[model samples]
Target: MDAPFSMYGPDFPFAYDHWLKHPEGLGRIPVNRHGAKVAIIGAGIAGLVCGYELMRMGLRPVFYESGQLGGRLRSASFEGAEHMIAELGGMRFPTSSRSFYHYLDLMNLKTAPFPNPLTPAAGSTVIELEGERFYAKTLSDLPPIFQEVAQAYDSALEEGAHFSSLQAAIQRRDPNAIKAIWNPLVKAWDERTFYDFITTSKAFRHLSFRHREIFGQVGFGTGGWDSDFSNTMLEILRVNVTACDTDQHLVIGGVEQLPKRLWSHEPEDLSYWPNGTSLQKLNQGAPRPGAAKLFRDPEGLYVTDRRGHTDRFDAIVCTCQSWLLTTAIDTQESLFSQPLWMALDRTRYMQSAKTFVMVDRPFWKDRHPETGEDLMSMTLTDRLTRGTYLFDHGPDQPGVMCLSYSWMSDALKVLPLDAEKRTELALSALSKIYPDVDIKSHIRSNPITVSWENDPNFLGAFKGALPGHYRYNHRMYGHFMQQTLSPDHKGVFLAGDDISWTPAWAEGAVQTALNAVWGVMNHFGGQSSLANPGPGDVYPVWGPIDLDELS
Candidate 1:
């Protein structure tokens, strides 16, 4: 009935996928403006992508990085092992992320279904919460309460958000229909929390509090929703409508490869740059040192690196976490309006910690003699180690295990611990759930761990918007339409998953980067091809709704 699932926006309902797939190409700048330099801060997916697309348009994008090239798409390899890596961030990417997939396929990388809980790829899942454990091959295999929880969430979506109709409109790419249903929701739910939605809904209220608790531990498409309970209901609804939690997959080599390849890979088609030209060659093999200060002067916008080397550009794209503007960098207050600055300062990010280890082999697949159950399974629990995922490389080679993956308060518990200590704490918790299995006996390498909040470059893993913060998100997201802004705030742009409706998801990063590309092109006095309209072309008619004081 509906087309293949896509995140076409219940907010800004534009077809970015079609725009990317079109034959006419994104657009072209005036011949005189072809070599204009745009400074891109941070080398994350957003920064790298902004660089890549601008490179294709023949504009020079100078990158400034304070840390690793791949920001949140971090993958750490074992000491000696080449490909045995632990994904530190952005593991499960949903199929609905067509914009991201466009680049993924262009790079010619491979993907396999992610091992999400209760999915076929996982083979089996074990959910342990409140001291009770259950093994299930699918949702039906779980006890009645699990099924009740699942059904109740579906019913609540229909009751509170008109999810079916809204999703159908998105699937159809029907802007008018989507806006009709979604705009009202923004008004009604902008001030409500995700926990409030669950408690107030008849679907969830009909069941006991245990139903809500169990559902939080094992939510659809991913590990847990408990970490997101305090977030705004509008944020949660966007994830659901976009299918951000379903049909997910992972890059086999590692997600970091996405940025790595894009940096070095040269596109066959080019407007002004030569075919062999790449972002890497342009930057002379590495990015400039980390940025320490940014200010606007009479000449243009000036970006100062950590080494005090300063460079000026006509435009700039800031792809780092917004907080960096205040905490890490000496950004001039005049660079943005007070309202826009408020949105950036007010943006919230959630903490995340992951501890991973390389094992001898896929030993977890080994079955018990007493019963045919797996020795261990992809786990979801209420303990300190909230979610543990198993990765099987092959029967012959070694395997990878995410000993513990947690967020919010759970992440803070291990924020102060070292890698070894975190691993020990995780193994201790797993032993409680799988008492018979000596998980330590199978270990083959030292543990690798990350607490993003501990890293000054990245204050937190990603954003989690709270109630009444929708306006902040709106202000940051739509600021790219800088035509109406004063001269000072027009050139610098913000682009990241944090600025997107679906925070923490890679698609959000991809979509917003594309939006920044459009804004930059327009800033340079360029327009999209008439044959295939870009987001900017359709944005005026399909942009996100405006919620003002009068409303």
Candidate 2:
């Protein structure tokens, strides 16, 4: 039988998990180059991962942050509450995300099953659409119409995308088998949108348009997918084939703790660094200020901070959002070729907004007096709130409530609202669905809200590749392979979820950061272990397929 599903490359099918777990460790830099400085722009998860691995390889990684240390992984605690927190960004992680788990396990963090739409973790689910409400303990509890909608999408995936066989290939870790199916699909679907695939598929075409609408509103694993209808079908396919939307778990306490712990974590085995040395020790107590400019001085690559403090490095890895390069930093144009610049400039980001309120307790689980059904459940709605999730912190302890978690248009709708107004808007929409439940009376703390797009440091939540934008993704994802690049562009690399095939997943950030680590090591004349070749060592052989430019 094939091995359990892993986030292996349907695109660049390298086993980053195996490479990281190898006994030989991730190659090495020259002894003379052990203390060479490398600038890591942005202290987000991606930046932290890159810095941690580079430090293990005996390189000193200097971090620069524009905002807080966690970046989008901000987990702000409620006033007066010590343990409860609002996870404002990337929360759900799949079991398939082995590379991310590699570090998460190393940090000794724990995770509980995320309360996705119909998972056991949720206990119960409430789907509200078109002002109608339906509660289900499982998918079988839903009406036949909902069942039909789900079946049609399943049939569509099998008929249109060869879903099962492709997934089996990924599970088996057969790069050749995956590419044979995926490369052809890339050519066939690169210019097609997700909506196009849904409308034109024989299975979906046979079903009513209402089925399609219901499918979008109550999407598989998560909530609504309607916001991503305009994205490339490849993006959606990648998420499905990788199980990125299935069997997800959330980091206990807060996801921020992973990056925070990694910042101070000292690897059991490392090169050159003294015992008990940590990333915290290398950079003194805190990171330098935000990088305001990226330009090359005659001597070396230079990073100028917002306060005009400057540092030179042998190489740099930028983990900030792509938009920041153009809007916030004065990066010399020559550092990137015209096509690459265009690719970065043209990359699209989907807006996402979230609102959270700490409640006195997990009141949502209380059953109605007359009915046996749950008083409230993990909610998915077409209303302004879009999706609502409840966090249970034992039976009596206070719980956190995510009032709204929305993306794209739904997110933009409340982009201008304050936390109080956003909370009011969410409660108003939810009232129509759960008029009997008084969510307002149970509130215990000030609401927390975030519109990532409104933050200059991150122009938007994450990337959303449009139809025909495959080339742009190709350019950005492959930028870390600097062997063929001009000397000017060789030293600088990009690593983030946005620079990955599967954006919005922490695994993407982890994998891309590994690629950047490989890039930095190779820049200093380092090499990978023969037994455990890095992504760069085998990238040329197993890299993503390239489509014709004319097409």
Candidate 3:
């Protein structure tokens, strides 16, 4: 499959590097603003990218982290394992996440195809439900009922949503064709839930309820999207149309390497900083203490660290999860208007949990005595274990297995359990699938587990938009372009996956970070070169059509 050029859709599909190539994004900063201070809150991909790009443009950006770096891009390793790691947060990168690949390519990270179910990389997949187990090497191998469910889904996407035509329009960069197809979809599906679309679409509604249940259990890309059924249909379309949930690659070693390397990397021909200067060298090898409070002072924006150290900056870009504005930090009442505050506070996040264990070797590779197949395949079950995945480092190296990867209701069940108990529960569930196999005997190290909902730093895994949430998203994404804000709100900008058209993807984080970077540049009197226009310079022409006007 060809890599997608856009993040949102046909209208806003320019690759981040391609957009930057437009003399507008070669990231030129005004000569006078070379040493201006800009405070970036959060060291996640969004914050780190914003700071890195700003530094390249010759501004001094100070970063603050309330927790560890890499935010949701975190990875966990076993005590003695050298190469094996369990991705605790964001793991897979789709070929269509063009903006994200700009950094991934620059870092030259090695990637392996993620083991999405039924895909070639997964090798084989097991779908078990209600005590009935079905094994398939490919979609063709699945039972007729299962194949019908898959076909119905494709038909619905094509008929109800114009999936293929929109994809072609995006490929061809035909603006009129894109607007004709995608704008209608935005109007039709933006207000509906995934379930609504599933139950009402002509092709899907013709199928039996059993087909819908099976489709929910083993979704087209990744695993079950039943957790997302209650989310907005627009959210589902964004994932599918952009190919974010398919053709994914896992970062070798760890995904955190992208942000970590960005921290230490130096760019050539910097406008202001020395040629060898990097973000690490600028912060003296450690970030300033975590921000405990943010408020406006008479002269400029002020940030108070956890230790009570206060510093003033010309502008502040907040890339942390939006809920932190109300829960974690001491934010002043006047910082954001009530409407914007509502959008930030109302950003709904999904609960997620992952438990991983290191095994002596890739034990699953052992062939079953009767079937001549690997004892265990990447398994998806309606049982307590929603999804089980295996990660092989090498024949000689320790291998990692994500025992029980679940979301929403399933994630809540293991939220109170410790790492050992989580691992034990997962193993117990797997025992039902492989009743004859000794799964626990292969354990080599202490198991690692994480519940994103249980962590204070990140209240939940990632934002999953609910129905009627398009207005909220529009308000948040447009914060950078708001010109009528009061003095206190003028300099503080919002940028994160939640503040983008599509949340929960690294591409969303990268695109929004660039938006905030441009906002800061313009805030300080910087301009994109006439030959190359920035996102802000070109947004009105290529952005999403307002759904209200279309309706």
TM-score of each: 0.99, 0.98, 0.97
Please provide the root mean square deviation of candidate 2 (C-alpha atoms, Å).
1.1
lDDT of 2 by residue, 292-395 (tens): 99998679899999999988999999999988899999998888888999989998999999999999999988988878889999999999888999999989
In each prediction, how many residue pairs overlap at the backbone (N, C-alpha, C within less than 3 A)?
A: 0, 1, 5
Clashing residue pairs found in predicted model 2: 9-13
How many steric overlaps does candidate 1 have?
0
Provide the overall lDDT of each model, using Cα atoms, as 2-decimal numbers: 0.91, 0.91, 0.85
Q: Write the per-residue lDDT of candidate 1 for residues 260-313, one digit (tens) a residue.
A: 999999998878898799999989999999999999999999999999999999
lDDT over C-alpha atoms for residue 388 of model 3: 94
Q: If both were scored by lDDT, which would come out higher, candidate 2 or candidate 3?
A: 2
Worst 10 residues of 1 by lDDT: 542-551
lDDT of predicted model 1: 0.91
* Candidate 1 wrong stretches, greater than 4 Å: none
Off by over 4 Å in 3: 1-11, 21-25, 547-551
